[model samples]
Target: MNKTFYSALNKSTVVLLFLAMTVSGILKAQKLPLPPRANDAISGSTFKNQIDTLSVEDSENQIYQEILNGNIPTFLRDLVPISFSKTIKDSAYVVTYFVLPDYLAVGSDTDYFLMPMTPILAQKIAKAIDFTLPTKQMVDQIWSNASVKLAPSPIPPSAQMTTIPVMWEHNTRLKGKRKETLKQAPLGALVAGHKKDVIISNKIYEKSSKPVVIYGWHYQNGTPIQPVYAGHSETYADYSHGIRLVQDSVLVNNKVHLISKVLQDIQKSSLFSGEGVIEKPFYPVDKIE
Candidate 1:
């Protein structure tokens, strides 16, 4: 080959190699692993057969017939899953009595029903049931009780500014109407159920130019005497420019008060630990969505 041609080919090869490396790096950054599959144990053919059997049984139900005939809202019909509990065969018949746009009924022992919806749909169904049942007062009572334990103490007049990260308190207890306490030294607050929603709504109200970090404590179950609190923190990125919340889960409670107001009161100390600017630079508007 001519020397000039050879040299040109070598140069081209180097450019190609660099392009390949850049492309590989981009792919690695973008790829996200999928969640585990639910039906991993079943063979594809066996699963198909099970679904066919369930479909046949579903077709025989009078209520299912009504749904197919369009008596119910299509969204409900499409969203509700068919669930069968072998322990309560008669309960299946009762589900049909509600005349809900979507429900399940079992006729055979081998039948299995799986809801074709996501967790969000389950929440919607729960909300719908709450609305029909009118249980807002009960929910409010629980939240109010929870809030009493979580409310923050008044910031001292002397303290001009503070910077705190989002924090959480796990395994806390709801004590008397006025207060809640932790079992150990690092006591945390009992967060209100609506606090997360309130924080997000406030960010929009303020037209915040910077990110808003919200610290919350999550309680799963158990009596107030020995409750569990998991420190949960989320950051809402700049919303004024249209970016939404960018959540980050920090394990450390750098500032104890950031997690709970009650904890701060007990210790008589600053809410955050290592900090630069504590108070939000701008106060959010009182109104929220």
Candidate 2:
């Protein structure tokens, strides 16, 4: 080969090596494996039907058990990447985390239900599956990076808002929106704005009653309808509530770190949290009776 051919080959090798390194970093950062869905696991719609007659407490328990048992949709196993850049003391840093493409659901890929449960139950499932709830800042990042953004559809305020029937009704509406969105964006792409996230906030620690902090029902234009609010009791879960699991693993400047550890780090916490040092970034789980 001539000198020109040799030089071109060397340049190509360098580009290929850089691409390989970039892919390696992404794979290493999102190494958590989602549990396989059991063959006998019921679909989300079926589970909803079974729980329709059950009380809120009973239904919440069922949701927790079902999720831990891996009775979740296959599609949810596809985690989407969300990242942000921060400049700390003149040094540029990038933090990234893998998140479920959509809200937690119960069922197989063909049939599933977007299940909503109390924060206590959501926390338990998150712990069992090696995931963590997102902070308010993380929620914003997800919304901003989402490929498919649905507009929030809030039902009129009524006493029945928290009922199971209302949940199913809301799910029906979301299904329609998701169907339309998929036409424009591929399946398993990051989706947001359909539901309010059950998030981890300092407000959860402020009250003795263990309130459930919820946020992020964004519009298509990157505006959230609900701000970070912890007004409801920990057990209160409505149709609009969703659980978006963040893999416990996070990449801080391409180095792998546990999300909990990163959030506790004073310097790194700013990447994920606007509020400093989320020392206890977890929902306090009240024991099920």
Candidate 3:
């Protein structure tokens, strides 16, 4: 009787210890805590009001500040993985990358502003979040794989295209279209179109001045309106421009490689860059301010 009671007690204690460890491990696997700057950003409506009174430079600065404070929609936080298979030199390679379901926006999921920013400001935010901008090839791939392909809705060409009010108007229009799209697609579905992507390219490495490479405002038919163009200054931004955040770490053939390194690799660049050997894949933010 004494031996049986001791055995039962030992089994009970071991079971409880195992359960406790499992729960502790699960908790540790959860997402890490947000930065201290999170939860201090203002709402979308308030940002709009503030933009009306701010200059273009000031407004762009504020946009970066809000992003730094984590003033983005909850949906944008969850990244969607995009995978594609390619064959090179008789070897089949699979490349998988993660990207935000939608372009970077400010405010809540219910009411957010699709913030358009200069390449300088955009690069700043990308660095803060440990993300990088897509290459033209990645932009094409993303548009092709998008679950929600919105038609390119271009506001007429004008000087005000880069102004704050125009940015607000464009955001409102996109929200309406997104609402209609959500009826057919899930909330966090990968979305494209409605804005041209500010991408990275070897063009930024051109002699002379730094330029921002803009590409991709695909139609429902998967045709992009804007080609890979680098005519605009790196600091140039308009209501039509968007920042699509790509996770820096990408999986190539099931092995992890940093995106910047992949772009620089001669053999692996084909997986992401159509132009071959991107060399310099990120924008320079030092002097744009």
Candidate number achieving the greatest lDDT relative to the actual structure = 2
Candidate 1 lDDT, 49-114, residue by residue in tens: 433433222322322232123332221221111111122223221100011221211111122121
Whichever of 1 and 3 has more lDDT, that candidate is 3
Candidate 3 accuracy as lDDT: 0.81
**How well is each residue in 146-216 modelled by candidate 2, as lDDT tens digits?**
88888999999899888878888898888888888677986678889999999987888887888999998
Query: Residue 275: error of model 1 in Å?
Result: 34
Best-performing candidate as measured by TM-score:
2
TM-score rank order? 2, 3, 1
- List candidate 2 segments past 4 Å from native: 1-34
Q: Evaluate all candidate structures by whole-model CA lDDT and list the values in order.
A: 0.23, 0.83, 0.81
* Backbone Cα, N, C clashes tallied per candidate: 15, 0, 0
The runs of at least 3 residues in candidate 1 whose Cα sits more than 4 Å from the true structure, single-residue gaps closed, are 1-142, 145-151, 158-160, 163-198, 202-289
TM-score of 3: 0.85
Candidate number with the higher TM-score (2 or 3): 2
Q: TM-score of every model?
A: 0.17, 0.87, 0.85
Per-residue C-alpha lDDT of model 3 across residues 207-277, encoded as one tens digit per residue: 58888889999878888999989999877889899999888877776566788898899887888988899
Alpha-carbon RMSD, candidate 3: 7.3
